[model samples]
Target chain A: MLVVNTEFVPGFEVTKVLGLVQGNTIRAKHVGRDIAAGLKNLVGGELKGYTELLTEARRQAIERMISQAEQLGADAVVNVRFTTSAVTAGAAELYAYGTAVTLAGGA
Target chain B: MDGDAATFNFLILLVPIVLIVLGAGVGGLTARTHLRSLERREAELTSIEVNNLKFVRDPGSAADTRMVLGQVVIATDYFKSLATALRNLVGGEMRAAEGLMNRARREALVRMLEDARSMNADEVWNVRFGFSNISQMRGKQGAMQVEVFAWGTAVRRGASA
Candidate 1:
């Protein structure tokens, strides 16, 4: 599948339009890391704990998006974008979405 | 000049230095943690690198491509942020975790895009991302995990065999 940030692929062409497709996920890490972070904050530099937190969260969200595309029988996605929001006091949410379509060769 | 006066003056200076070190350490740690978290999250999204291409035989229908993208991209980003925020608190030498995650996202996206291209798809249409967090949130046996996904339609342009 030819995927590009632009709506059109210079060398490739679109052939069909599939219905709307999307993916979403909700995640909450254990609070232990947070407390550790708070304490670590007192000493300051890099909070190693939160680094792990963000890494894990990003993985989960991306996984869900891929699964959704698979269900739609999409070979590729283009112009992918990411967004985030605060769901609760301690929890946050990440989401990804894009267009799904079929393509033809330039030749 | 008195001995007592000298001791008192020394103690006052010592107190400020100690407080400053403690304050600086804490501030630095907190900032690092927050920055690391953001980077780690970006890495996570990069880990999968979901790519979607949508296209049709008729160029006139190109408008629909944008329409679908409007929803798909927003949703994907939303879910990606959600996952990152959920894991925002995880700490301990986990700084720069985003570097790894970003790599993963890119790898995944490239692989999927290559697969689509091999299928002779000119583009992908109606592309969107989906996310799921199957990890348990409560209880001693619970685990935390986030999955990010990117999806789209592969199409042939101007009618193909």
Candidate 2:
């Protein structure tokens, strides 16, 4: 399925609005990564471990959102948006949402 | 016992002072270096058009379009965290924290542009950013960190609509 953050795809017209589909996941950093992060904080730089964790979490969230769209018979997802929240000190929640729609000619 | 207590107190004061000094020296260098690198890369990638507009005015025969994402997590050094803590009491703008967040955002966007470049895309549209604080807390010691996620649709110009 096609996914774009814009309201409409460049060359295609949206035929049906399948309402809103969303997915979210909460992930916690492991102890090993946290210790490494604490040390990295001293000098200040990119936390590769945390970055990868977030990327993985975001991918999972998007995957779930896409699966939901597929279930709705959507050819594409439009106007996609992502949000994140710190559920606690060590865990964060990533949420992806979009309007699922069917294109005129379909995907 | 009295002499030992005095030395213990002296050591306690010296530890944080040393930490702040290290943080200032190293962390400052890291931020400056990253900023300079970002500037250089941004200048180099000036050819790629990037914008938040939902639609491109002239796609010029869109060849292909796909979603691209870039993310980064940056942590603040002890010095900045100390500055923030002090600024909290004054109830003023925390410039140190602001700089940290700015660096993270720029880094994420730059990475996204690089991703588009790799795909041989000319422009990126509908760009959006997401941010979060992923600092782990440990009692009174919590490292300050910010995560920036940038995403957009990369369009490759071709002979097709």
Candidate 3:
């Protein structure tokens, strides 16, 4: 899965454009990490706790995206991009999207 | 005379200076941490806006290939509300949540676009986004699930998207 903000993937030429593919997951790590961080602020340095929180969130979201691509029967996903949102106060949403393309021609 | 001078310095100078430095450090750290939290929240909001399914025309196809993306969120408003309420209590950043939603929506769109192409369409045109709330009620509590969906028509492009 090659993800990018741009509409087209740079290195490779897209030969076939498959239909839509997507994946998503809702998470609660933000609230927990924030609470932990609030306490850690008393004695501060690098925020290791929040870092872990974010890493885990990213993993889950990516997994969901792959699952969606599988469902759509895409050979590969190109021009992928990531986006995040706070749907509610504590919970967060992570999404990855791109074009599912079959590559044959070399760019 | 030396002993007296040392004692005087400790009593009059070192104590106040130490106290002031400690106070400043604590205040500064608190402010920095609070600012970070706020920024994280703002980022999350921005990601949500970014995640919105925006259809784009495929440049490669000579035929018009228009694609629209949407998603099945698979999370409930109630769950979001509760999570948010908890965050308010603990003072957590909401940006992660927003990012997640945006990601989901985009993925949905991507899949739809791929599906269109598989049909050997030159391009998808007049792509549109549509959503359905698939929340079901449990015995006591309402279920938590929302599907973010993106749909569009695939057509061979002779004209520009």
Q: Which residue runs of candidate 3 sit more than 4 Å off their true CA positions?
A: A1-6, A30-34, A42-46, B1-161
DockQ of each: 0.11, 0.56, 0.07
Model 2 spans > 4 angstroms off: A105-107, B1-6, B136-142
- Which candidate number maximizes DockQ? 2
- Tell me the deviation in Å of residue A3 in model 3: 4.1
lDDT of 3 by residue, A49-81 (tens): 543444466556666776776776665665455
Weakest 10 consecutive residues of candidate 3 chain B by summed lDDT: B134-143
* Evaluation by TM-score, superior candidate among 1 and 2: 2
Q: For residues B1-161, what per-residue lDDT tens digits would candidate 1 score against the true structure?
A: 69999999999988757655665455445444644655665464342223333433455433222211211100112222233445566744433335324433433344345555555555554455544332222221112222334445454443432
Pairwise lDDT winner, candidates 1 and 3: 3
Q: Candidate 2 — what's its lDDT?
A: 0.86
Ranking by DockQ: 2, 1, 3
Candidate 3 structure quality by residue, lDDT tens digits, B81-105: 3444466679969643454345445
Best lDDT goes to which candidate?
2
